[model samples]
Target: MKEARYFYVPNAVTETELPADEATHALRVLRLKEGDELFLIDGEGGFFRAEVALTTSKKCVYTIKQTLKQEPTWRGGIHLAIAPTKDMGRMEWLVEKATEIGFNKISFLDCKFSERKSLRVDRIEKIIISAVKQSRKGWKPVVEPMIPFHQFIDNCTSAGQKNICHCYSEISKLDFFTEANQSLEEDILVLVGPEGDFSFDEVRYAMEHGFKSVTLGESRLRTETAGLFAVMISQLARRV
Candidate 1:
């Protein structure tokens, strides 16, 4: 088996000092000794194979030898936009699971019906780092804090197919597979609503902005579940 990979928030492929927290993890928690070999990732596909040169309870210093890049599997990159859950743990779970499944971007939206209105990007970043290392993934998903529904929708381009997961009755709900193509390589974004679902105005706004309505499964899902469900569906569609 390969040595476990760890992501450093800041490290110099040239001569970068590992972040204080990550240094503590390596030196104290993991008990890595000087001259031990390990892998370091930046979460954007950049990787380094390095050897620890010095270790202290508060820090671990390493000398990086080489750089490697990992390619993302999805043909068209995957981005998931959703409302954040009021509970921090639920949102953290979303970040971890989505990172493991390979989402390039995640944006939190503030909708009319959104229960939670704020988020801490730094905390989310830590969760993502842990998830990437645990899942043996080199790339880290970009996590954006809460933005207004209108602004978020306005910024999205008509590049690849844009879709929304809403619970509206008027909208035609189809299994993600039906609308998704096997040859999909275009940038794809899926918008998931909150616990109470997107407000009528929000749904209309997304629809007017070129987001087609879609469903993940029969039962209703929470905000985080819907977001991850979209990630899973998008990954599966890409592989088909």
Candidate 2:
């Protein structure tokens, strides 16, 4: 018996040949040959069992043998919107780990004190795709482009539990896990601040926009750590 290989194919149904990047991996890295079994994920909750139908120096074609859809392990939606870190590596690590842990969406914020105002989501998306394939996740997390702090807050008008984590001492906040609604199927959104943290006014604005103030723990955490911490807490709260 042979182990199964997985590839990211956006439209596996209508497409026969793997995407250029995937083809390169299949042909050069993995050296997949004709009739070899592999799996495909569309990144939109579609999983497929496929077999290599043809192999060429520059092309790898596959035929869908069976559709293997996977149900999400967790309930409800987990959304984390945070200011990107100054170092791209840290932010990239967060995206990769968060995808492996399972989350529905991620958004980048441009905060007043943020060190990095702009980000290229393309590279981050590629990291996410690789993580999804490695983790065998059926759904891919949506990475929204970086938007202004106020604008992101204003647009969060959905009917779900919302929260903001900040480092302000004077402000009162509940423990994230304790404050989060325990109902597994409820939608949840958590906002994490940047390295310099969200300004007092931004925190106030988020609160005014229906986001509750929450705390991760006693130990101070960096921007990326806080973001990942929030994601973990949100997912854990739903399990109780």
Candidate 3:
């Protein structure tokens, strides 16, 4: 079985301290002693395989024994920009699952029909950290704060495949999965709307900016579900 890993804010090479809660868990709950092996990850980048040199009720100190350059598992890149669910718990769930499925970036947008306008980044960061460790991943997704729908679309820097998963009544010119040709490297950005869906104007704005509208499936999924669905579909498409 893979060893349990934990995210430490700073790169472990320099002397570092774990957060109070994490310290308590590692030293007191886990009963990890000096010279024990544990993995440390700097959320920014890189993984440190370290040997715990000191342990106390309040702290666990380690000596970095090895360093591994972290890389994404998927050769293809996937970024999902979606509206946050009104229920904060559901939003957290989305972050966890999407991280496990290998999302490179996640952004929140305030669409015309969005009901929840604000989000707590501090709490969301904690959730992402937990999800990254849970999935045994070396790197975490980049989570951006809420942005206006149009502004988010306009700021996209990726020149590869761009798509929007919407259920608008207009007949889509092409399905999202079919829009990208196999010759291109696996980089894609998929936009999903809020509970009430994107306003007609926001949809037009995205289309004008080269975000092709495509459907996830015939069934209408909730905001979080649609976001997850898009991640799964894109992952599969890249493999094929």
The top-ranked prediction according to lDDT is 2
Expressed as tens digits, the lDDT of each residue in 98-185 for candidate 3 is: 8887778898999888889999988888888888777767777888999998889889766778888777787464676665444347
TM-score of each: 0.90, 0.96, 0.89
Tens digits of per-residue lDDT for model 1 on 88-170?
79989888988888878888889887779898999988888888888867677888878999999999876888888888788
- In candidate 2, position 112 carries an lDDT of 95
> Which one wins on TM-score?
2
Clashing pairs in 2: none
Model 1: weakest 10-residue lDDT segment is 7-16
**lDDT by residue for model 2 (1-240), tens:** 877789999988999989999999989989999989999999989999999999989999999999986887777899999999889999999999999988999999999999998989999999999999999998999989999999999998888889999989989998888876555678899999888899999999999999999999999999889888888877777753
Reference-based lDDT, residue 34, model 1? 84
RMSD to the hidden true structure, all candidates: 2.2, 1.3, 2.4
| Superposition error at 194 for model 1 (Å) | 0.8
lDDT, candidates in the order shown: 0.80, 0.91, 0.79
Q: How close is candidate 3 to the true structure, as a TM-score?
A: 0.89
Scored against the true structure, residue 94 in model 3 reaches a CA lDDT of: 90
Task: Rank the candidate models, highest lDDT first.
Answer: 2, 1, 3
